[model samples]
Each structure stands twice: as C-alpha cells, then as structure tokens.
Target: MPISSAMAVKASSRINSMFRILWLSAIVGMLAACGSVPLPPEPPIPTAPSAPRGAPPLATPEDGAPLPPARIQGRTRWQPVRWAELPGFTDDALNEAWNAWIRGCERPVPALARLCPEVRQLSIGTPEEQRAWMMQRLQPYRVEPLAGNESLLTGYYEPQLDASRMPTAAQQVPLYRPPADLATRRPWYSRQDIDTAPQARAALRGREIAYVADPLDALALQIQGSGRLRITEADGRVSNVRLAFAGSNEQPYRSVGGWLLQQGATRDASWPGIKAWARANPQRLNELLWSNPRVTFFREEPLSEFDAAFGPRGAQGVALTPGRSVAIEKDSLPYGTPLWLSSPGPLLNLNRLVFAQDTGTAIVGPLRADYFVGWGDQAGEVAGRLKQPLALWVLWPR
Candidate 1:
C-alpha cells in the first residue's frame, strides 16, 4: 500500500470533503424540525409610569362609558267609587254615626248601626251603594284603608278623646289653625318626661326608626313636629288633630323610617356619632329638609283638591281603566309601585294612576290593592264611590 506522496495527499483531501458534507446535512435536518414546532408569543410589558404610592385607583364606569338609561314601563287601571242614595246621609247625627263606623271601634259600631241602619244595610247592597255608604260612613272618621288589603287601614285616627266631650260642631273650630307652635314651647321633656325621653334615647341606640305613608307626607309630619295636626275638609272646613307621639319606650321606627333610609344615616352606621352630632346641633335636626312655604297643614282634611286631581281630564272620582292594571308575585312587589287599574264600572272613564307605595298593617295577602281618596269630604265621597270589584294592573318600567 506504499504509494507516491502526491497520491496520499489527494486521498486525504477527498476524505475531509466527505466529512464536511455529512455535518452540513445533519445541521439542515435539525433546522427543518425546529420550523415545524410552534413557539408561544411573549406577553407585553407596561410602558406607563407606576401609580403614585398609597393612592386608590379612581372609580369609573365599566368600559369607561356612562351607564344605560333606566327603562321603566307599566300601566294603571282606573278604580271608581259608587255613592249611596240613602236619605239623611248628610245629616249631623248620621255624620256622627258614619264617623263611628269608619273608626271601626267595637263600642261605636253597634251604636252607629242603631242610629244609621242604612250603613249596615248598604254594606251588603250593590257595590255602588256599598261604596257610597262606606264613604258617607267613613267621611267623618277620616280613615282610609291602605291599598292591597281589606283589613289594614292607613289613615290617621283622631287622638284619644278627652273626658269633657265637646259637640261635633264645637270640635270643628280648632281644626283650622296650625297646632300650637312647639318650637318656642319648652321641650315637653322634663327630667321626669319618661316616655318620649326613653324613645329619644333608644332612637340614638339604633332601636327606633322613622317611617311614613307617603314620602311627601313624611316631610309634612316632620315640619308639624309633635304637636297637633290640622286638616281642611272638602267643604272649606277645618279641624284640630291630636297626633300620637311615639311613646318614650315605644320606638318611632315606622314614622321616620323613610327619612332615615334617605339620609344614609343608620343606627348601625355610627349611632353614637349621630347622637353626638344631634346633641351638638338640636335646631338643625328639627328643621325639615322639604318644608314648603306655600303648603300649610289642612286641619279639617288630609288631602287637598290637588291630591284628588288625577287622569288626563281632572275627573271627579277614581277610575281604573282597562289595560292598565298589573299583578306581581308577592316576593317581587316593592312598596310605592304606581299602578293604573282598569275594571268594569258605571263610569266608562279611562283607567287612572295611583301610588302603590303604602302597605297596610293587615294588607299582607296577595292580589289586593288600596286606593287613596284625598282627605275629608272628597275623601269620603271617593271612598263611598269605590264599591265595584275591578282588576288592577301595576305599571312599572320595563
């Protein structure tokens, strides 16, 4: 195998070239496999400066846009009242008897029935007569049951009567003027003032709350304070009202409930703090936020002509027109759902709107409703008119 030196060199060069070609081919195969295998993209890095230390991010609407408008839709039917054609309905004795029946006092009903058998007879009469009779009976009492319940009435009852009974005509005099101003009057509380005193303390303790039938009415109550209330009757008559003050031990939670909820002040949320603030500022607490200079207390009646004015054509009575009533599941019905009720009645008028915001003490059953008549004469008239059974529809935002 001994060959020439030139020939040996040539053979070595050929061997080296073969090895280089094989290495290149192996590198190319690895590059092709890598191209087929997918790799994940890298996440982006924030370029903006960091927020200031210890500062919370500003709150904004989701997606940095304003919220959508509320979509509310519903209809209320009109419910009308039918009055009785009984003789002597407007007489003084019958007026007294009617008032007694509306009060529903056990003592008064029997006496009232004896005096005005028409009321008893009408209770079972045609719906129209029943309504009319009921109105005539309830007018003098000034009490109307709240909507949606048969047993629970929401109108104010006269304060406990004193022993020296005054004639009904004599009682009418004090009803016009506002109750004596209590602001200048010394606090009814002495160190001995046990009842309202304890209640005041408990209210601070978060045990008592305030409530009202209507939010607007609550405003009036706040302004009137703890003194007597006055109402204006439909016939331009006035009367004095003795209001029931929250007993010292009994909480006024129901009376002022709306005010408390509106204020965002709660017994739970710093009761002691509120008490301290109230103690420091007594005058500010007594002043009502929604006091109207033009609106005065109507001593002889609870409602004004304005209160009775409803519907497109200011009709004289309440009517529940068709396609306006609504029914809601017991669980979903919230207080103060305005409704338009409709049903068959003597008055073929259109359905009307009413505030469904009040709840009866006894109106817990489902599918019931309460209709409010403006206070005093008109109220009595309207109450008497509401005898026909009509379906109600609740109007709400869709």
Candidate 2:
C-alpha cells in the first residue's frame, strides 16, 4: 500500500526527534564517563531586596552622568535554558562537569560568550557555572574535524604538564616507518605521471580539482586527478567548474563554466578577488587560485635543527633552511607543539620536535600540516615521503 504524504511527514518528524534525543544522550554519557571533578559549594542566589519607600529611579544613559545604557548595542540574543530541558542531570553534577572542562580550555567562558552568543542561553547550573558550561559546550564547535582514524577525533586524552621541555637530543628519534604499501605514495601529479598540459587537461576531464603554491616562490602548483570542480558561490549557489591542467609551461589556472565576465581578468588570488573573478569569468578562468593541497604537509626539521642550521650563523657556507623548513605552519595546534611522527620503514622511526609557528600557502585544513624541508631536492624528498599517521601533542606553556 502507498503511504500518504501526511503520514510520511509525521514519521520523518518522529525520526528527527528520536535522533536528537539519541545525540543528546550520547553527549551526556560521554561527559559522565569522563567523570566530573567536585567544585566548591556555590553561594546561594540572593533574593531581591524590597525597595525603600522613597528610593529614586535608576539614572538613564542619556543623562549627563557617565552611566552607559543598560542594554549594550550589538548584544547577542540567547535565552536561559529552562529547568525541564536537563531531565536527568543534577544541577551540581552539571556544574562540576562544566567547570572541569573550562579549567583546561585555552579560552575562558566570558571571552567565548562574546564571540558565540548562542552560548548565552545554555543552562550552566548557577550564574558562575554558566560560563564554565558554555565553554565546554563550545569546544566541539571550535575544532574542525579531520578525516582519519576515529581515534584521532578524541585527540590525546592525557593531560600534559604546562612546561616547555625542550626534547633532549637523545629522546628525539624517529618512532616508526609507514607500511610499505603506503610508503611508496607520490603526489597526485607525480602518481599520474602527467607532466604536460595535454596530459594534465586530459587527466582532469570530468573531475573536480584544485591547486597549491610553493611556499617560497609562491608558484602555482597544480593538484591534478580529482573528480569535477564544485564551485560554491557566496549565495550558496553550487556550480561545477571544469578542471584543466595548463601543462608545465603554461601557468596552471582554473576555468569557470560560463563566458569570462569583465571582473574575471582583474581578479587576483585573494579570497574576495577570487570570488569576484569567479563571478566575472563565469567560465573562462583557468583554475581556482586558492585551493589547498590534499597531501599531509608539515614544516620540516625540529626547532633544535632550525637553531643549529640558522640561528646566529654558526657556519657561513651552510645553506639556511628555506621557507619549506623554517617557515612551515601547523594547524591551530600552536607553535612549539611536540609531535610523535611515524612513517614507513625502520629508517623513518622518530619523535620529532615541531612548532606551530608558520603557515603555508597550501596548509589550511585541520588534519593537515606542512613541513618545510629546505627547498629543492630536500623539500621534494620530504614532501614525497610524508604519507603516514602523525600523533601530535601541544606542549602546554608553563
């Protein structure tokens, strides 16, 4: 029998409600399993004092006095959570859980609230607890999820001491090599063996694609062999752009589907310029200029190596680390973070020191990090050899 439209809609709604409940239950369970630390007893909320018979009204902001308006401009709209919303969690338990989470957070609650007004209405037990709860709830949103083993999603669970322990030279050794099957990986371009324009264009046919720039020279490096370009406009209109590799000699560029608009010719690689150019070129632009590389890039060499190689000139003829090694950037994990890196083979085993001090033209995504291995052959070798899992820890500042 065919189901009625009304019945289908009702079933969908019920399913959505159940899904929300399940998600909420999972979050609560995870928090419970983590175990909340005990907090000092909160002082009782004060009752409003009865007004004296002749009490004057509060002064208005418009008066000569310096009092500001009671309601500030550009305030966020968030309402307090109702008691019924948190069914099973006790107020004290919730408060303790929130505080434990907040104490470890880099950004405190009030600062976070200014940025994310949605947190204002969330129930956090008492007024003091509100800030802590808000911080805990917001942590998940700030982290950009990466595609990797699900275990990576939880990150390193153990608490690290807040001190800068320069890894002793002895302790800094490669840990493991990537499996042989994964070790021989090459860049998409290298893998395809496409070095010419005709070959690149032919390879890109009917596939989505993008490009990255060399850190030092900022040269347009084509990332070929993806399926179809998905160009999303500011208005959320998604259009398919054609990917065309301009060959080794021809500058790699992006091509929109429509005729080139006047704005297309003038659009530089900047975000606004790219959008405007995309709008104008509609179809003529050769390639999207700002696309990031998909490979797991890292800023190469440990801080010790950097200092020994470049710090205050120990040797005159020794080449200083180029942007690839000295200026590579990590994700928001911050500079000076220690990462336990493993790649294929016994030779590659070592825990290396990395700082999140630099950013690269191609390193934008969360799971991604770019290692500068000094330019030319060294950089190429390191870039080519970087296809393995890396465990990272932000050495907390003392």
Count clashes in each candidate, considering only residues at least 3 apart in sequence or on different chains. Answer: 70, 43
Q: Please give, for residues 179-256, the per-residue lDDT of candidate 1 as tens digits.
A: 233233233222123223674233233221221222233333322222233433445555444332322211122323
Error of 1 at 61 (Å): 27
Q: What is the per-residue lDDT of model 2 for residues 237-336, given as tens digits with 9 covering 90 to 100?
A: 6443322222231222332211223334553433234445556654533243223222221111222332333211101111222221122223344332
What are the C-alpha RMSDs, in order, of all predicted structures? Answer: 35.9, 23.3
TM-score per model over all chains? 0.24, 0.23
> Cα lDDT of all candidates, in order?
0.29, 0.28
Q: Model 1 off-target regions past 4 Å? A: 1-332, 346-350
* Residue 243 accuracy (lDDT) in model 2: 25
Q: Report how far residue 302 has shifted in candidate 1, in Å.
A: 12
Could you say which candidate leads in TM-score? 1
